[model samples]
Target: MAPGSSAFKEVVESHPKQMNHKTLKMKAESGTVKTSMSLAEKHSIHGVHELLQCPTCAGSMYPPIHQCPNGHTLCANCKIVHKCCPTCRFELGNIRCLALEKVAESMELPCRYQSLGCQDLFPYYDKAKHEKHCPFRPYTCPYASSECCVTGDIPFLVAHLKEDHSVDMHDGCTFNHRYVKSNPHEVENATWMLTVFNCFGRQFCLHFEAFLLGTAPAYMAFVRFMGEDSDARKFNYTLEVGAFGRKLMWQGVPRSIRDSHRKVRDSQDGLIIPRNLALYFSAGSGQELKLRVTGRIWKV
Candidate 1:
């Protein structure tokens, strides 16, 4: 046994089986072992095995890696350690592991709100953006009490409020068909009238609260309903324009007065008066309506 030659023979002669066993044990403990049956295989068995185990904890790995302050590779459990990097003392703000991020990106994730009709899939990084604008996001209409049941995206909501929940805004007089005057009595010259009809068939009469001036006009209106007192109830439905001379004349004679006649007429000609009748208009300046109605109305 010459010097180097004797050393090599000794190494070869040593228990090769023991050496292999030690190597396998070490690799297994590190979660890096794989069955290499051939030089090439269907999948990279070692890489696949490693993929299944966290490089930091040597435990079962989840796809996305939550990271710490210092760019230390960590398993989810270790990654959450006081928000400090496990490998260094870096203070973490909001760290994310690119390696795990890439893994998550390659995997398909369904929208969190998918059950609510959101049919979008997104990579890990884009998840927040998709969630922010998902069509299934829940929202409530601002004018919910005013017969507006519309609900949807912000733009849709705004359009619904403008087109459906809007009340007829009047820029001119609601009666006399004239532009509203600086004084309520001055409104007598204007013929335009304003009214709001609720879904419940109740009627409200509107009048100018202050003089019409500048671009917008000030307005005031009273909502009237049947009262307990007969006298009060007698004028219960009266929408008086006062000095403005704009009056909404409902069929003053109640059904009690015309019921007999109406019944006879219906028996003869089948004519009927609608139970709920109301009108809508703009008073002084801005005029718009949320619902359709009948009546010869105009804006002054």
Candidate 2:
């Protein structure tokens, strides 16, 4: 081999690993290391989302992310319960993963309820807040009976209530019904009836229940719009019950079923009748209950 070529070859062979490492060190120190960390990259969003997921809970990591001595990180909620790194079993420390937190601040993500028909993108910081109030969030079954665990979007829940729960469905804004019971005095904290009424291309739930209003046994009747609260505000309803020339009426806005039936009932924002008054309106002996309820719903 030529003299110069042979000398160069010997130098390269003597410390090849060290020379390559020194070059990499220089690139890193100068902030010129070629990396796929740019946000402009096509896969960067997905990669960042994956990176921010807590190893322990698989949830997106928020602020105060804690790290173990070996650089493994977990979310704040998991940190409180975990004594070691979930990823590497390394002993955890009080160190916060500030780098990861800063990275999250620079990102944007689609709503977690995108599959539920929410077509909105939010910055990482505002994502949780938007998701909390997202209209497309799944709704629990509105069946007055507390036995149903079903939850889904409006159409799915509507079908579920009809087919699975066998709930009555009506097609009018005005309704009149007679509720009869064998024992008017045997009042308990239980749901009595739930009727679905479709009007103005929307659905409403008329809920009736017997519960203790403070210390007195009372019966409550109310209506709930099966849509978002904002849309529910566009409508109002009136309920009236009468007998023996005496009548009781309540007029108010229909609450959104987004508020659970129990929640609305407990709020007592509906027409409530005391057990004694209800029996007085009955057609027969005080032991039997036969009360008539008439209501109308209108767009406001």
Candidate 3:
């Protein structure tokens, strides 16, 4: 071979074209030198291109950057005539494009829900879509009713119930009993009688008990007493029968069989005995069944 050809042959032998091709193939397969620009670089280029586009006259735009209320970034030309965002008609505001600044700086973006589901990295603009469809989003209703058959998200269910089923909602002690007084006499004579056998001389107690169908947790037994015509004294008693009667022990009275009474000092149109008095049964008959009630009463 010629003298110059000899050096060229040596150089070619040392660094073969096949070796270079192999190295390039390995790099391509390993994805080290990507063919296309990265997502962040692409976003930066697009953002810059958009910044240069004129929104008002279809011409090129010039900075400083402004944003609409809907978060659309626009140039100064668009802000002159447009009090609102050109794209969404939202009100415009003076805002900086820190995101574009960040993109220009080459900061790495993360996948939305990286703390929830995903660990993969992504461009900042792609994060919104990822988070919108995240699988682990937590949801709960604010109004959860334990007693009724209603169950749903609180705000929606509360508004629905208020509008459509307002009458169904009631406020009171859930433990109290509701009854219509059929016999006024039974109610009037409630304070003095040992046992109110009838209401208005009618058997309303028996009917009330039967109407309850044994489902009530407690029984309400009203009793009345007749006093001589010295002064018309009235009494009302509401005996809480059954296990619930045990609560009366806190009132310094035997929850089982207790005696209590009040005397009428002044004449106030006869004594008006309050209802809701509790009574306990004595061991035997003729036990002097005292009235354990609260209210003024004249002693005969």
TM-score of each: 0.26, 0.82, 0.19
Residues 1-300 of candidate 3 have per-residue lDDT tens digits of 111111111000011112121110001011122224577775975676455455556653333656765667666666777888878877777776566445433433333334543444433344345545433222121111223344332234435545643312222111122222222223221121111121221111100111111332221222112111111122232323222344231111111000011111111112222222212321123222222222111112
Prediction 1 TM-score vs. true: 0.26
lDDT of 3 at 236: 30
Ranking by lDDT: 2, 1, 3
Better candidate number, 1 or 3, judged by lDDT: 1
Name the 10 consecutive residues with the lowest summed lDDT in model 2: 7-16
Q: Tell me the tens digit of each residue's lDDT in model 2 across 31-134.
A: 11222244565387898889888888898788987888888889999999988888888888899999999998877676677777655556777788777777
Evaluate model 2: give its lDDT.
0.75
The residue-by-residue lDDT of candidate 1 on 175-273, one tens digit each, is: 222222222222211222223322121122222122232333323222221111121133322222222333333222111111222232223221111
Against the true structure, whose TM-score is highest?
2
lDDT for predicted candidate 1 compared with the true structure: 0.33
The candidate, 1 or 2, that scores higher on TM-score is: 2
What TM-score would candidate 3 get against the native? 0.19
Please list the residue runs of candidate 1 whose C-alpha ends up more than 4 Å from where it truly belongs after superposition: 1-66, 69-96, 144-300
